[model samples]
Target: TIAAEGGGGWKEYAGGYSDWANYQASVHQAASDKAKVDVRPAARPVAAAAKAKGDKLSWKEQRELEALPERIAALETEQGQLTTLLEDPAIYQRDAKAAQQAAERLAAIDDELMELLERWETLESRAANQG
Candidate 1:
């Protein structure tokens, strides 16, 4: 069994990562079929927030903060796509290079996501601190 945090909650899959990926794809497909509107939270205005915090962030840092959400979202989308591709057993035989590249990209995405999330949290705290 694989335990994971997903869809704003935690769930345990009965099998391994492939099973979890299949389940997630099915869920996403069903949601898309329903044409459900995605209501994402608004991104904070980094410039204004940084200004309010009185130079807590430099201009470059403010720009980085502003771009974080979109960059994170793009990486997540790519990760999901790579996971789906890797789940197909035929992919290994059909094109080994493609499969290998996908796997490498997925690993890179994982590392990128971790770094971005940590930096985002640190910047958010600095931007929110009154002192």
Candidate 2:
């Protein structure tokens, strides 16, 4: 005998498996039709504004935007080297003074890197908003 005591055992209560499957299928088809009817085309005013803004950047702003990646890369390389020195056990063991100096330099590099990243993000957001 079919058990109808739990969730999804509604098939037995609905008069059997076939009836339950038909009801679920009809609900799914109706939802799919509603979604298709609600779809919209892209808005034209926003697209035009973005195109116009992209055309309006000053030459210097364009150049700086292009150069930011290379500048960030060089700073990151310097930061990595300083980090290695700070992490080395040999440096700490053989020359405690040098290790401390390396740690201080690493901290300064980290600060500079953070500032550069902030500037880069600001410029990126400005460009996006203008577009």
Candidate 3:
């Protein structure tokens, strides 16, 4: 059973945790879907900025810049997973060495992400300035 208070006052749901979790996920998905429809999606900032500035990049630089976002996203996802693993006390209890490795990876990901973002900014600036 889930009890939540809102503008409509108190409401209760008759379901177990899994059902409530599913309902919550569906509600979030509905909101996200609605937002996607209601909003006018804009081009990615870097791409739009590059286009506006006339895209002075070599084909190689342009491709590298384009691929950076996906690479950054993958690193970020791995970082989040590692962070969650580290946060669980059971992991340390289960395998101290694994926890240490996760911590090291999380730190490495942070550094890598920072470098990628810096590279992105530098590329964006280079594109704008050369245009």
TM values, all candidates: 0.57, 0.51, 0.56
Provide the lDDT at 24 for model 1.
Answer: 62
Q: How many residue pairs clash in each candidate?
A: 0, 1, 0
* Tens-place lDDT digits, model 1, residues 30-59: 456434553323334643565576746777
lDDT of 2 by residue, 11-71 (tens): 2222346644543465456556545774435435644564666645567767878898898
C-alpha lDDT score of every prediction, in listed order: 0.71, 0.61, 0.70
Give per-residue lDDT, candidate 2, residue 16. 47
List where candidate 3 sits over 4 angstroms from the true fold.
Answer: 1-55
Candidate 3 per-residue lDDT over residues 1-131, each given as its tens digit: 54465676754443466645554565466556555665434436856776676648878888988999999999999998987886565675688678666766666687679778987887878778877
Off by over 4 Å in 1: 1-55
Full-model lDDT, candidate 1: 0.71
Error of 2 at 11 (Å): 58
Model 1 clash pairs are: none
